[model samples]
Target: MRIWSQCVKELAQFLRDRLTVALAFILPLLTLFIFGFAIRLEAKNIPVAVQDFDNSPLSRSYIERLYATNQLQSSRWDGIGSPQAALDQGIAKAAVIIPPEFSRRIKAGETSPVQVLVDGTDVNNARVIRSSIEATTRFFVRNSQLQTNPSLIQVRSRIWFNPGRQESLYIVPGTCAVILWIYPSLLSSIAMVREKEQGTIIQVYASSLSAEELILGKGLAYLIVGLGIAAVVISISVIIFGLRFAGDPTPFLISTPIFVASATMFGLMVGTRVPNVTTAVQAVATTGFLTALLLSGFIYPLSNIPFPLSLISNIIPTRYFIPIIRDGFVRGTGWLGVWFYLLMLMLLCLLLFNIARRNLSRMQLPD
Candidate 1:
């Protein structure tokens, strides 16, 4: 009865604060749209300067081939003496120079060297540019009667799952998980700390309400709020991004509330330990948001992280949940693939709730 009463009171108080209510609903959707549209893993339309000193038909064909993939575009190096100047001035990411003998050598069935300069400022972009140049050169040599002897081995490539290469299929589900993790924890942390900041927690210490009831009650309210947030953001993602379930949604449906409850419990623990609401917010932002963003494999694979950081990712619940959500949209492996992760997620949630219960127990009146 006390748990129900406390839950109602928290819900009522939450609804009364218009700003908090708006933050709960509005901010998450905005984050979803911003992250969905803005982030891209592949680099495209990189500008390159082409100095074709040969100016022959073969060189012209090669230049056209370079731009055929839509990955590279011609960049102007006006008032510059050399192709290198374009890179120095940041006008282009790469420069290609064809020698005078480029056409003659190739025509005589001899290898011709073309000087290519790439900006090393961003190593990944530089790698992409190098690969593009190499691939295009290989295509030109193989298909344009430029190779005197054809290689004995012919390669045929096939792309598996997500052949259309819709990036949203890769991005939106992970974004949904991150949004769900961060916002509920932030809101619940604020609710827990607000009572302390305003000195209203004295009543709890004086009342008969057990620490379990208080934590469960407040967490229950915020769990409902988190569910509502999830529904809105997920529906918007489906409508905007055309996402549909790839596997059994049963696991995703079962795990969401457990994940949200853990977030609320994490917030409650922070509020219990911190002196004020500001510190609680900062704690959640640093511990909750950063871990989810970097360690959870939301943007990159966990194996890519260094030894110690990779170890840290193991404990991040988001690490476990991202695979589940991604499986829901892209992999469709079903429970056979994701059951272990689901179990790990549930264990982590229980751990978080226990920690919060223990912390709040120290501050409450004895039963």
Candidate 2:
């Protein structure tokens, strides 16, 4: 009954703390809006250089088709230099090289390979541009040969995992990871800070509640609160925002505790060191936002980052959780695909929780 009373009192106090309430409610919406605009895979307004060596109608029509896709916005060639110069100068993502005898080669039923020099700097974008170019060229070739052969093969392409490429689906899962990164800190930090600020932590310091019990109690309190917020966000993401949840909820259910535990311990560590509320908020915000945007596979894919940076990111809990969440939701991957990440998260949580408890137990208060 005493523990129940203490829990209820803490809940009420949590409700009354304006900063806590604001963080718990208002901040998630703000994140949703910011990230909704940032995570995009489809490229628009890509620049290219066209080298029309043949000076034929076929070449002109192909160039017009590239423009018609509405993907590349601007294209140019000085006609004084090779397409390689354009690519080297970063003036073009791709250059279309048409051979001088392209028309004659096609008429004679000879395959004259039209070289497409694509900038492979961004593998995904390069693939998109190259695919579009080849697709257009293939269509022209097929139609031209149809009169001679009388039979043409039709081609169809099926896109998996975000067929429409709606930014919402990608951003929502990333947003969930970002929220987990910051909210756990906000939840755990405030509770401990309030105790320190209000002169109540001293009672626990002098009592028989042991360092582990106090840490567990505080962590459990924040976990329940954090999960409530997570549930609200998930409901909003799925039902209100129309983001799909393709995989079993069990993965999320299994992994969230581990994520929250790591985040909570990290927050407790920060809370123990900070002197005021503003700094606490700032510490969590800076660490959380940077970790989510840079270290986690949210704004950039892990493979795209350099080798050393990628290794550093592995230590970040979100680095593990984001892939699992994305895989579970977007790819509909089963537990087998995500168990490794889940294990990493659990191990990190255990390590952090132990460290936080040790630190909290060591914090000295007035006798």
Question: How much lDDT does each candidate structure score?
Answer: 0.90, 0.78
Q: Write the per-residue lDDT of candidate 2 for residues 203-320, one digit (tens) a residue.
A: 8888766667777767766777777777777777787558766878688788987787778877877887787777888888887668777888887888888978788888889888
Candidate number of the best lDDT: 1
Show where candidate 1 strays beyond 4 Å. Answer: none
Off by over 4 Å in 2: 1-6, 47-57, 74-135, 146-167, 304-307, 365-367
**TM-scores for the candidates:** 0.96, 0.77
Model 2: how far is 360 from its true place, Å? 1.0
Error (Å) of candidate 2 at residue 176 is: 0.9
Cα lDDT, model 2, residue 30: 72
TM-score of 2: 0.77
Candidate topping TM-score:
1
Q: Write the per-residue lDDT of candidate 1 for residues 174-280, one digit (tens) a residue.
A: 99999999999999889998998898898998888878889999999999999999999889999999889997898888888888887888888888889887898
